[model samples]
Target: MGDTHKDLIFLIPLPGGRVARVPIDVLEHYVDPSARISHGGEAEEEDVTAHSMSVDPRTGASIWHTDWELGQCDYTDENGFPQSAYAWHRHPLGNEYTEIYQK
Candidate 1:
């Protein structure tokens, strides 16, 4: 089956045992800015959100998550070397916000 379209909300538990209510399909934009989990002593920025989690806070379990995927033949270059994932990223050009990674 394809992606389902429905009005839904997810209740995610947060720090201090707080629970966050987030709308389906748009949780990333609504992440709790202050939430953080130990990732090499740094925050996971986009993954460790109150609305969405890459890990299970209780067990420290995690799964791979990436916003983009490579297309079939888009994996390598003419040299047969793996393409850099960073090359696919485009910074937010034009002044919409002072922060470059706002989105």
Candidate 2:
């Protein structure tokens, strides 16, 4: 019964030079509009992509960690199409999370 439209896509690029795109939201109701929703106009939901990497687990060394944020308000390319940004996560922590933007 909501007036908004939302779509989500999960992408995984394999080392074999192949990309897999999966629609996780359709598989499970992890997110619900009826649940605690945001009200602010600029408070639009966004989809996040995370990449994790580490040299050694025990030492937690030879490197550090990092992450990136791409909001719904971002641009794709020459076209005005809205595209998600590439998120880089150094450690395999958190939900590997992403946001669902209201369109």
Candidate 3:
């Protein structure tokens, strides 16, 4: 029979020798679905790798290190100027999840 688990869990290592048991759904909500480690507008699928994981002490949120960076948003400002957008990192328990974070 196929797997029947309701959700998959990921064991993420954190700073200070702590580990987080995060669910797949939480990961999907915090991580950008389209994010990829790219350069010159070309997606380097094979070379994509996470450098490290840590907690933002100020916010108590988990952070994932990667070469991928977020750029301007597709929509423009009131004067038709591009606006900046931020990349997503793993923050399973962070209370900042919004529609933008959804897959």
Candidate 4:
């Protein structure tokens, strides 16, 4: 119920057509999640406004429902600077059914 306790998670897009969900605690020391998110390169980037993700931490069901203008993207760059790959999903702890992006 408080923002102070909120946490962040990262979703990595895989070339094989599956998303990898990694907890922020496991990546914060090496990766920046924000740097990997963006509205595509369209003249008018499609805004990802509604997202519904539920993870039963105990069961580890990291599935999500996101409403956005879909596009293809690469998750990591050649330098691995956390590219905004079209396959990642972020889970901001405690912000249930949160809105992740605004076009």
Candidate 5:
């Protein structure tokens, strides 16, 4: 798929931690979908975004979005439980996961 006109939508975090994302198009910050990105690699600070949109099932309209981080990890210790493995998912929709991570 080409540009969904939905790429690189971002929320610039404020110093006070009050989250606010502009609903306008800032052409300079758009990340081209076709551009190649290294798999499991760290994206630059500017490329990181923190917003998720949920469309209304019935209306097909974007009814909600939020600026919060959700971390997902998969690692097991010798005991077979969850190990404290950590990493960042720095893709376009990256959450900047709360735990430590490598690119």
Candidate 6:
């Protein structure tokens, strides 16, 4: 029997206000994780907000893509009551592709 895996999908924005539903497996095949900027801590996983880079089939230029990260509330409300909590905080990871391209 073949191995079974969960389907992880990401909605990526395109050039003309269009979006594409891409699979995690496809992104992994094209993008190199080490090539991109690092974020978060040891407890944080690259498991969220998938980002990747790939070549445009038509233009033959490299393009960086990303999905939305899950948000959470970690602070207390104005009433001084605990609102909610997040497992971890998200950090800004700049575009490695753009930096390289601009050079």
Tally clashes: model 1.
Answer: 0
lDDT of 3: 0.42
Candidate 1 lDDT over residue span 1-103, tens digit each: 2455545777864434467887677876667654333222344554543221245455565532232211111134457665432222121232111111112
Model 5: per-residue Cα lDDT over 42-90, one tens digit each: 4422333223223333554432222322233344445756554323323
53 in model 2: Cα distance from truth in Å?
8.3
What is the per-residue lDDT of model 2 for residues 1-103, given as tens digits with 9 covering 90 to 100? 3433445666854433467876765646665443221121232233122222222335533322223322222224446455554432122243333333222
lDDT of each: 0.37, 0.35, 0.42, 0.42, 0.38, 0.42
* Most accurate candidate by TM-score: 3
TM-scores for all candidates: the values are 0.23, 0.22, 0.32, 0.27, 0.23, 0.31
Show the colliding residue pairs in model 4: 74-85
**Higher-ranked by lDDT: 4 or 5:** 4
Query: Taking the candidates one at a time, how many backbone clashes does each contain?
Result: 0, 2, 0, 1, 1, 0
RMSD of 5: 14.7
Off by over 4 Å in 6: 1-5, 37-103
Rank order by TM-score, top first? 3, 6, 4, 1, 5, 2
Tell me the RMSD of model 3 versus the true structure. 15.8
**Predicted candidate 6 versus true structure: per-residue lDDT over 1-103, tens digit per residue:** 2344437777975443468998778887888543432233442363344333333445645543333222342334467665443322222243431111110
